[model samples]
Target: MNELAFTSWTESTWVGFDTETTGVNPNEDLLVTASLVLLAEGVKGDLSQVETANWLADPGVEIPEVAAQVHGISTEQARAEGRPLGEVCGEVAERIVDLWRSGAILVGFNLAYDIRILEHSLEVCGLTSLEERAGGYGPMVDPLVWDRKLEPYRRGRRNLETLCGVYEVSLDDRFHQADVDALATLGVLAAMVALYPSVRTLGREELTDYTAAAHQAWAEQFNRYLASQGRDANVEEYWP
Candidate 1:
């Protein structure tokens, strides 16, 4: 019989991406180091993640001390080892577009920040924006958003490390390294879908829409909380 078999989410190949940037603000930040992992599904239903590429960009400006403290890359180091900004940006853009063209979903922790910053980098380099290249940010799967949906009541700083603990996955590597974090994020996603197998049934588009909706609701509630405390917050109500 000719058949269309149902494959779980892990059956699909994923491009895991992460960046250690100059700052938290995507608009002002410059890429410091970035890594992309192409995770292929193994024959035994395991993952085989290969580090496809890594980049260090000469941002043409000093990386702030606060940011360096977080990612452990000093401005002096970047100047010594990083490539020209335009060249690095162009290469990264091409890589992302290639992934999209190949129909691989992008995965990361707090991925909207990374996507926005990458888009900003491309535009600043006078290359095509993400929208122009891939039609729009889509088919992205963020473990951060998924965790909030699966465990809404669990509280207190759900950073990448914390999520790893919740998923019972050990992140043995040093945190804040782009390559390590990207690989860890891929593990986290696999763990999530394994625990909540129903979620794995959703198609790529379905998952993206579901994540956007959840983020929108979360943003509304968080904005209201900020108003209660006389503060202003406008976190975007969507992810890549």
Candidate 2:
């Protein structure tokens, strides 16, 4: 176990996770593409040396035009080339557990969405839940979650592309590709830790706890904002 309480964030193994899915609703969306990668930053997101796995699934449903527009994966393409969701989800869970068991922290943008949706997919395929498979989610480093905590006053949309620019990382044309998104999220994470001295000093487990609490605070504040706007607040209020 990495018992060190003050390891440099850039000096540790990070497992980046991302997915291109059928929609935004975790309870309803299907994962179309997913990527998991093991990397340590060499000046940031330089993925020249990395171990990675990616999966494309048929999802057993039509891809919505809007989603396909964003991700560039048509239902025709997925049906023609994708694997069964059963094999895909099982393999993904196994890889994730394998990486996390060895002490690699999970890193991503807004990762809870992908994870919860993946758990739903596993249920659809009768596979074990990721929580059950891994026992629990490990130490995590979510740039999206942390960014909200660190810079709540930062203006504009919080999309990956926008935040990537805010962090001075070049995302280019890879906005929706799962592998690219995962790697870019890793870069964003590296940048955030480098910028936030307070976070840089934390152990992975400590930071995970901190992010979880920050996420809950953000959710509650957002729900209050939504209520004031006279809309139903239905965001997921817990971590995956």
Candidate 3:
């Protein structure tokens, strides 16, 4: 198969983003936690960067056990220490939009969910839409999508914890913290590029397009996978 020219994106700064929210539904749920790490200033031989900030928001609601279990932030802790929900979210959103405006690429594990959540927060805070402010921008890389496209036959869990093992990503701290998850996501992306040298062929913008399409293709591929496993194989959500 012919390869696409995708090189310009290679030199761009990649910002890692992650969030632990009150729940999954962007409309109803609140963004209780968020983090960002600049890949450009990462440590030697890895994409991990200095901890910029770990944001905790009050969410103005209870943090259910299920949500607390995932992120380790409790309602009591939040009430005592978390900044106002609007304030923390607003600052994160501003930094994100600023990063994009300055030409850095925002990379995340499941970027769509994180970005959508951030976008929702920005709208509520009366800030300009990130998409519009950045002129329809997207990430330099998205690890969850990248891994499925490049290593379709690989097995085992693809979640951050599993990838931490498969890719030798250090998860020294307990998992699910926003900063740790962002760092792990970057590690996964770095590992995928190393495993599949062909990915380097695409530049920044091309890489963005490739990842978006490849992720969708991977979803279709997984549906077939479900069929092979004799599962229901009847869902329609395919990583658009």
Candidate 4:
């Protein structure tokens, strides 16, 4: 099979994605909200050219207080205002698949977690997973993985807020809201590309492969560190 030709990062379309969930475990937690921001080529920062979608899911479970505090979505509010879990998951999955099929690269902060949570949500809702629908997860860009690999030595913390600070991306106090986070991820990516022009030169496939390998390398190193500390070393060595 001939591989599809891919444009450079600066010239490509990007779908910035994010999800706020009930908890951290993708396998068990439910998706409370999700956002997708589309940044078209040559108009990356222009609000008029950008397209956006946000979903609020009832999740069919009580929103934990801690999770509620993080994302500011309560179960009562969700029950009253959010759509059904299956309907929201199905629509989100379909939108993502359509964008991927149209050759838009997926962008996210820490994408693996969001992807896994969406995949699990689809399964729970009896809908097709994104992997199955999109054929594969690739042609994706994760700013978190890129930042860790690019600046491995200089880091106090690597969370989204910290990265936004490091990259000079403006993120207000509404950090955990899916839409805000997704947009911030896009800004951070732009900043990274500006600081590291070499990344913008790589083709889409090359960038995906590079980031995947970088993520696996980081996972392996971190797991070894955990083992050295006599803790369970269970970080999954995979990228979204």
Candidate 5:
């Protein structure tokens, strides 16, 4: 495989990943659904060159009403239709590792959450973590980080749906489904590269370092603001 670099991102393979979980906490929550949407080289927005893999896990716990309302996956439905949690976690981890080994850049919106959840799930299942398997977590692109860095003053929600709107990317499907979110993330990234020459020009390692530093800077500023308001704040200073 050719060396992975951001300069040729449009002609490189990308794997957009997303997960829908039972709750908001990565440490306590369980993954209910996960998806990987692959956009091959020279095929941005071309469905014909895309491939996808999706999974639903039984989770081994009740899918809370709030989470079910968000993702439309009831516990009863999951128990009946989903695969075992260990099986799902192992498959998802291995598939992601395989893609990384094949030189695909991972793309997501707020990917750190998903990556942490996956890491927790693998530990729970007694399986190897993604980092152990892949030797590292990235080459990755997080549209959330880039959007915040590029347009810091544009203040509204930066969630996936809002980003799709901001970037003029279509989100034709429902919001919380893992597959739909993954595809929407890819669309947003494609739009970002087209609009921001800086994003298009960075090399792979350079972009990784840039985003990591950017996230740390944002975390520090946010923490200071929270401290001024007398609120407890400890936003993570790492990137995915």
Candidate 6:
């Protein structure tokens, strides 16, 4: 493995990403939420200028109470303010694809969900898949996986909020919404990279590959923990 210095990554621009969904299955889940924030070097833009966006699209199904409780976007409100599902998903997919094409690294706390959902949305919109848009699936980063790999035995929750706290990054907005979550994810990612300078030298592809295996290991370990705690470990859902 390339033991690259992490400071080299500081020069790369990262697009912090997050999404809210009606459910967990990308193929069936409707994206009721989405956001992207640019995290460039030397200047962390105003949380306001972070280039954020959100949506409450009609899922064409009843909004589950548990999911609604997390995001507070209900079916009625979505119907009142939401655009057609195709339009909203298409717009989000196109915007991110354009960013990827422009060479910004896609960053997030748990980016797999966002990427998978975006790919599903693109398919639904008859646009190219995100993997295709990014030219053979590349240049993405996720701080959650980074943390797990860098400190496998460390304690405490691995959620974005928890990472923000560990990183001393402020959480200034609603937690589950896409906009704030994306920014928070970005902050956590920056802090992790700064803390682990070894990762700075990793090319985007290497970083993503490392994160993929680390995240899978984390999920397996977490499921065992949940089982020990007598909780139902829902494997199908993204570990949001």
Least lDDT summed over 10 consecutive residues: which range in candidate 2? 1-10
Candidate 6 RMSD to the correct structure:
4.3
- State the lDDT of candidate 6 residue by residue for 1-240, as single tens digits: 134344434556678788888777766676777777776651233444555566657756677878888888888888888787777777766777787676678787768877777777657657666666556665678887788888888888888887788888887857988888888887777666666757766765576677776777777887888989999986542332
Q: Model 2 over residues 1-240: C-alpha lDDT tens digits?
A: 123234554566788899998998888888899999788642243556778888999999999999999989999999999999888888888988887787677887888888888999999888889988878777777788888989999888998888888888775456789888888887777677667677767766686788888899899999999989999997667865
lDDT of 1 by residue, 25-115 (tens): 8887878888898887511134453656899998878999999999898999999999987788778777887886777778889988888
lDDT of 6: 0.72
Task: Specify the poorest-scoring 10-residue window by lDDT in model 5.
Answer: 1-10
* Consecutive 10-residue window with the lowest summed lDDT within model 4: 1-10
TM-score of each: 0.90, 0.91, 0.82, 0.92, 0.93, 0.82
TM-score of model 6 vs. true structure: 0.82
- How far does residue 15 in candidate 3 sit from its true spot (Å)? 1.3
Once fitted onto the true fold, the runs of candidate 6 whose alpha carbons sit more than 4 angstroms away are 1-8, 42-49, 122-127, 217-240
The better-scoring model by TM-score among 4 and 5 is 5
lDDT of 2 at 163: 80
Q: Residue-wise lDDT of candidate 4 within 162-190, one digit each (tens)?
A: 88888787755489999888888888887
Question: Which one is best on lDDT?
Answer: 4
The TM-score obtained by model 4 is: 0.92
Per-residue lDDT of 45 in model 1: 30
Shift in Å, residue 107, candidate 1: 0.1
Residue pairs clashing, model 1: none
lDDT: which is higher, 1 or 5? 5
Q: Which ten residues in a row have the lowest lDDT in candidate 6?
A: 1-10
Model 6 residue 238 lDDT? 35
